[model samples]
Target: MTAARSSFGFKDVDAREKVRLVRGVFDRVASRYDLMNDLMSAGVHRVWKDMTAARLNPQPGETIIDCAGGTGDMARRYSRMAAAVQARRGGPDARVVVIDYNAEMIAAGIEKGSAPEMVWAVGDAMKLPLPDACADAYSIAFGIRNVADVSQALREARRVLKPGGRFLCLEFSRPSSEWLRQAYDAYSFKVIPTIGELVAKDRDSYQYLVESIRRFPDQPTLLRMMREAGFGQAEFTNFSGGVCALHHGWAV
Candidate 1:
C-alpha cells in the first residue's frame, strides 16, 4: 500500500485516508481557519453560513446536533433561535450540541464561548457518539466531504435524528456554468494553496482541501445518497451558480 500522505500537493487521495489527512490539516490550521476563510472567500462565507442558518428554520425547545460543526457558529445561531422559540412557547430551555473530531477546532470553538447553552464534544461523524431518534434536526456545514465514510456519516445522521427531524448539509458543489467551473477550478488548484501557504503556512493541506472538494459527490449524487440513508425527501438548492449548495431532507 502506498503510504498515506500526512500532507500533499494536488495528488489523489483515498476517500478513507482523506478523513485523517483533513483532521490533521484542520487541527494545524484551527487557529487561523476563521481568518483564512474570511480572506479566501472575501467574507462571503459569512453570507453562505447565514443563508444556511436561515434555511434551517430552527424552532424553540428543539434539539439540534451540529456534526463537525466548527467554532460553534451554527450552534450559537441555533441557541439564539431556540431561546426566542422558548420565550414564545413558555417551554423548557433549548440548546445546541456541537460535535467535532478535531480537538484543536473544538478547543477553538470553546474559546469563542458565545452561548452558555451550547455543548461541545469531540466525536466522529461516521460513528457519532449520539443517541438514536433524539435530535430534532442535524446539520453539517462544509464538513461532510472530509468524513472517512460519507455514507456512514449520513447513516449516523439519520440514526440520531428523530422522526420528522430535518437534516441539512452545506457544502461546495460543482459550478453550473462551464466558464465558472473552469475559473473555480483554477482558483482551487492554484490560488487556494497559495493562500494557505502565505496565510496559514500550509500549502499541502490546502491542496488536500481542494482535492476533497473535487472528490465530493455533486448535488444530484449526494441527494441520492441521502435517499439511500433513509431521508424521505432529499433535495438541494444551488447557490452562487452551484459553487455552493444547501441540501435538506427529512427523517419521516
Candidate 2:
C-alpha cells in the first residue's frame, strides 16, 4: 500500500515523515516560541487569546484540555480564571491539562512554573491519551494546523469531550479582502522569515511556518470539519480582519 502523503510546509512528504519534521520544528523553536509570537504579531496574539478565553467562559471544577498548549500560556490563564471562579463559588479548582506532542515545549512550560490546577503531558493531538468523554472543554490555539491529520485531531477532540462540552480552536486564517490578503502576504513572506532568522535563528523553520499557514484550511472549511466531527452549532469568528479566527462548537 502506498503511504499517505502530507504537507510539510509546501513540500509533500510521507505522512509519518511530516510528523517528525513538525516535531523537529517545535523542538527547535520551543524555547523561543512565545517570544517569536510576540515578535511576529507585535503582541496582538495576547489580545486574541484573551478574547478566546472570554468566549470559553470556563467554570469551577471543569476540566479543560489545552491541546498543543506550548509554554502553558493560554492553559495557565484558563487555570487561573477557573480558580477565580472556584474561589467565588467555594468549589474545587478547575483542572487544565496542558498537553503537547513536543517534549521541549512541555519542558519550557514546566520551567515557567504551572498553577496547581494545571497538569502537563506530552501527547499527540490525533491520539490524546485520555478517556472518552473526559473533558468539559477543549482548546487548541494556533496549533491544530500543524497536526498531520487535522480531521483526526478534530475527531479526537470530539471523542474527549463530554456531551454538551465546548470546543474552541484559534488558528491563522485567510484575510477576507483582497487588499488585506495582499498586505498580509507581503508581510508574511518577506518579513516573517527575516524575523525568524534574527530572533529565533531559524529561517528555514519560520519559512515552513509561513507556508503551513497558507496550506491550512480556511475558516468555513474548518467549521464544516467541526460539524463533520459531530460538533453541533459549529461557527467561527474572524479576528483581526481574518488574519486569525476563533471557532466554537459544542459536542451534542
Candidate 3:
C-alpha cells in the first residue's frame, strides 16, 4: 500500500499539498497580517506600496483587479486614485476588485470597509474565475511569492487583462547594497519572526515568511518570467535600496 501524502510547507509534501499549506498560513495570519507587516518593515512597507501605486497611474473609468490584495490596501488606494481622476475629468465608473485566496483575508478587508468602490472576493491567482479581457489593469502586491506556482499566476493575470492592460507586481527583492542586504537578511531571519511572536503570536508563520522571501526569484529573473508570460514589455525599479522591487509590464 502507498503511504499517505503530507501537506505543503512540510518537507515531505507534494506540490498540491505545498500550495494548501501556503494558503493556510495566510488564512491564519489574515487579521494580524497588516500589523505584522508594519512591525516587520518598521512601517516602510507603506512607503513602498505608495510608490508602487504612483507608478500604476490609475485613470478614470478603468477596472483593476488586485490579485492577492489582502486587506484591500491596494484596492482601496487604486479606487481612491481612480475616483479622484474621475472627479477631475467629470466622469465616474472606476472600480478596484481585491481578490485573495484566503477567505479570512477577504473577511478582514470587508470588515474594514476598505472603500465603497472596492469589491472583496476569495479567489486564487493561479486560476482566476474572471472572464477574458475583463480587467484594464492587474497587480499583485507582496503576495505572489507565497503562490505555489508563480508562473501560472502571471499567465492567468495576462489572460484576464485587456489588450494594453498593465500589470504590476510589488514584492520583496534582493537588497542592492551589501551592508543593507546583510542587515535586511539578519532582520528578516531573526527580528521579523521575533516581532511576529510578540505581535501576532505566530512565529512559525513569520519564519515561513522570511523563508518564502529568500526562496523567491530575484528582480531580473522575475522580469524575464513576465516577458515569457506574454507581457509586451517588462521592467522593474528597485526600492528601499533593493529590499523591494516593482515590476511592470503590459499585455499587447
Between candidates 1 and 2, the TM-score winner = 2
lDDT of 2 by residue, 82-105 (tens): 888888887877899999999999
User: Ten residues in a row with the worst lDDT in model 1?
Assistant: 3-12
lDDT of each: 0.86, 0.94, 0.86
The per-residue C-alpha lDDT of model 1 at residue 73 equals 81
Clashing pairs in 3: 8-17, 8-18
User: Against the true structure, what is each candidate's TM-score?
Assistant: 0.92, 0.99, 0.94
lDDT of 3 by residue, 1-252 (tens): 554443233244555776788777887788899888887888998998888888888888788999999898888889888888888886767788899998889898888887767877889898997999999999999989878778899999999999999999999999988999899988888798888888888889888888878778899999999999999889999998889999999997
Cand. 1 Cα-lDDT: 0.86
Ranking by TM-score: 2, 3, 1
lDDT by residue for model 1 over 24-137, one digit each (tens)? 888889998888888878888888888888888777677899999889888888888778777787777776899998999999989977686688999999898888999999
Model 3, residue 26: distance off in Å is: 1.5
Number of the top-ranking candidate, with TM-score as the measure: 2
Candidate 3 vs. true structure, TM-score? 0.94
